[model samples]
Target: MTAHLITGAGSGIGAAVSARLAERGDELWLLARDAGRARELENRFPVARTIVGDLAAPDKLSWALSHQELPDRLDSLLHIAGVVELGEVGELTPKAWNLQLAANLVAPAELTRLMLPGLRAARGQVIFVNSGAGLHAGAQWAAYAASKHGLKALADALRLEEHDNGVRVTSVYPGRTATPMQVKVHQQEGKEYDASRWIDPESVATTILAALDLPRDAEITDVSVRPGR
Candidate 1:
């Protein structure tokens, strides 16, 4: 069975992807903020292990992964943990901007750095869960957009740097998925939450699985998924 480490595995696209992988009998190491939710996955899948903590803090993240006794080499590292703080440039504070950068960009970079050797050993894949916000800036999405764009840049850099090492890096941009984060974004806009209008998290997870399923000789450098109107 393939061994994979997934962050933000408690809910949303993270949880959906975990479920899909379970069906295929993958060994999973799940990192989530909620211990309860992570443990729930352990109950559902015999191959699942739980690591509960804040992914944004390198120390906490490192501690959790170390304590969990993960496989020495991972087949894939799926980074799905992120924070979205929406605000116009003028309204955005240093704290808000920095938090978004740390969680959405820096955290993933740090985790990937820590996991690089194992990924290299296994010739593994790294998938960054980015957003359409990375591609275009909206009236009140400057901070979030900036962070995601940085994530895209990070992925590109990693892909080039690790290509010779046989590690594949992919950045996936999903547009307005129907996740709890979207509910928060909608509430900030004072708009009624409409789940039907947004892309399903499972849809995004399926795309990720596709990227992971590719032949060793083939690489999908980038993927963009948007809901049908």
Candidate 2:
């Protein structure tokens, strides 16, 4: 069985992806910041392992990575941990900007680097759940856009670097989705952001799974899934 490691598996798209992978009987390591939620998922799935770590903290992430004992090398690494900060350039604080960078770009890069050896051994895939905002800029989304753009660059670079090792990297840019992060952004902006009109989390998960199921001869470099209507 292929082993899959997922971050931010406690809620939203992360949770949905974990559930889908478990349903397929793939071995899973659910990494999240909340221990209670991780335990709940473990109880429900009964076939998944849990690791509690805040991706924003390098030391904590490194510690968790060192302590994890997987039965086999990881065949896939799905990075779903990201944060969005909504504010104009003048209103953005240094702390908020740094937090966005830490969670969205730096942490994912570090995690991928730390796990590269195992992925190489298994000829695995690296999946990045990015945002449409990363492709097109928006007003008052400077920090979020910058972080995601950086993540896109990192993924592209890694893909080129690891191509010789037989590791494929897929970066998925999803449009507005019905998730807590969308709701939070709507609340913060006080705008009537109709998330129901956007793509749902399950559909995004399906796209990700499809990429994972592709033959090793073919690789989907990047994919963007937006709402139909």
Candidate 3:
């Protein structure tokens, strides 16, 4: 059976992807910071395992993976954890800035590095849940944009480095999805954000799974999914 590891599986796109994989009979390891939410997902998907740890903390992430007793090899590693802190250039505090980087960039990169042996052993794929912000800059998105851009770079570099090892890397740039994170950002801004008109979580998950199903001889380096009118 194919084994897949997904981070930030507690909600949003992560949760959707997990559900899809489970339905396909794939063994899944779901990682999230909220134990309660993870447990909820575990209950929903009896065959899935949950790992509760804050991805923003390097030590915590390391401990979770080391002690969780995962399979010897993984077919796919999905880096879906991310944070969007809306702040202008000078408005970002040091703590908040670091946290954004940790959650969005550092943690994903570290987790992939730690799992390289398993992925390479299986000739697996690494999928990054990047954003359109990573590809194009916008106002009042300094921290989020920087982290996503770094993630894109990381994925690109990993693809080249792992090419000889037969491990593929794919980055999915999703435009404005209707997720809790988007809702929270709208609430924080005290403005009406029309998320219903945006891309749905299931669509993004479908796109990701499609990328994962590509032939081993081919590599879908980058994919951009956007909502249509």
**What tens-digit string does per-residue lDDT give for candidate 3 at 1-229?**
9999998777889989988999889999887687787778788778998777677896567777787776679899999878888877878898888998999999998888888999999999999999999998787788889999999999999999999999999999999889999897788677898977889999999999999998877889999999984
| lDDT of all predictions | 0.87, 0.88, 0.88
- lDDT tens readout by residue for model 1, 175-208: 9999999999999998999999999999999999
For residues 33-94, write the lDDT of model 2, one tens digit per residue.
76787778788668998877677785578777677664358899999978988999999999
Cα-based RMSD of the predictions, in order?
1.7, 1.4, 1.3
Q: Could you give the candidate ranking by TM-score, starting with the highest?
A: 3, 2, 1
lDDT accuracy of residue 24 in candidate 3: 83
- Candidate 3: residue 182 lDDT (0-100): 87
Task: List the candidate 1 regions with Cα displacement exceeding 4 Å.
Answer: 34-37, 43-46
| lDDT assessment of candidate 1 | 0.87
Error of 3 at 185 (Å): 1.9
